[model samples]
Target: MFAVDTSPRSRTRQYSTSSSSSTRSMAQRDSMDIDSAALLDIQRALDIARNTEGDLDHSVEKYLEEQLTGVWNRLESRPNTYVLSKDEFAIFNYFVGRYQDSKVAEKAIARFWSSYQDTGSS
Candidate 1:
């Protein structure tokens, strides 16, 4: 006679296996590389910013435009990862609102580098 196995442990084991597989697939998708089209868009934005020449306000606007594009690109590259946390976004927005000149842009860039170093080291 044929018999069927109906154990609780077997059902639990099957569920766990399926859950783990799904998690792995999600992780793989999250870590996928940046798309080429996105990279090209970023490069084009950077090129526009780099080629622009004018007074301080013009330069800062250009630089900020490029920086914003970069942040967006990074976010796109890792859809599951945030390029800037809430706090970082607040700080960046405040800086952008308050500093619309070339000198401010320079200071902001310096601050960005310092913050990058701090985060990178830890």
Candidate 2:
């Protein structure tokens, strides 16, 4: 649901592939290409923060303003998803702005939902 185009959603800096029939003595290794959604988020974040002074949360907020609704729509559709947490805003800002990768942010949110367990303390 996060991917708006026909592209991947996430990627890592490094990846490895085993070589069973390679002439080289080492395995093949390369950097994974980032998805278009993440790339777009990066570009948009940069554009938003270009003239802003200090406080990256604002830029993140702007980015979220454009994408949060879509994400929430998906989350709201599923039962037992999107638990209310105290760190919600902080988590949102970090994922949405830290690396300017919304695709990862989306994935992170989904992950949090599945892994979240209420301790019944707060």
Candidate 3:
């Protein structure tokens, strides 16, 4: 036979012992995952350290150029209102790193320009 609660009002229920134990187990697993992730990051850092400075710089430049091409094209299509700095590649790098997608980075650049216009600040 199945019995149902027929209370007139709903009330907060306390956590059961099993559920509490499960919650604790979940927290432990989460911490373990974080630890493993940190270890992986350290390994990657060591691998990068083995590379020479020129190799690292070349790789970074290659990545930035590959990622920023679409972003540059998008900026090129915009109206010539703001005097943009042609050498300002850092902003493109920042947005690309933040989104890691050309389309999304283009959209973010559009929004940035929109906000700049709205602010009316030179």
Number of the predicted model whose lDDT against the real structure is largest? 2
Global fold similarity of model 2 (TM-score) = 0.27
Q: Stretches of candidate 1 above 4 Å error?
A: 1-56, 83-122
Q: What's model 1's lDDT at 89?
A: 42
Better of 1 and 3 by TM-score: 1
In angstroms, give how far residue 95 of model 1 lies from its true place: 11
In candidate 1, what are the lDDT values of residues 44-80, reduced to their tens digit? 3333334434322233344445556544444445434
- Residues forming the 10-long window of minimal summed lDDT in candidate 2: 25-34
Model 2 residue runs over 4 Å out of place are 1-39, 42-51, 54-63, 82-91, 94-122
- Put down candidate 2 lDDT per residue, 3-107, tens digits, no spaces: 222226431112122334333321111101222223334334434344334443332445544455444454455524444232333334434554355454566
Error of 2 at 34 (Å): 17
Pairs that collide in candidate 1 are none
Q: What is the C-alpha lDDT of each candidate?
A: 0.38, 0.38, 0.38
Taking all chains together, each candidate's TM-score versus the true structure is 0.27, 0.27, 0.25
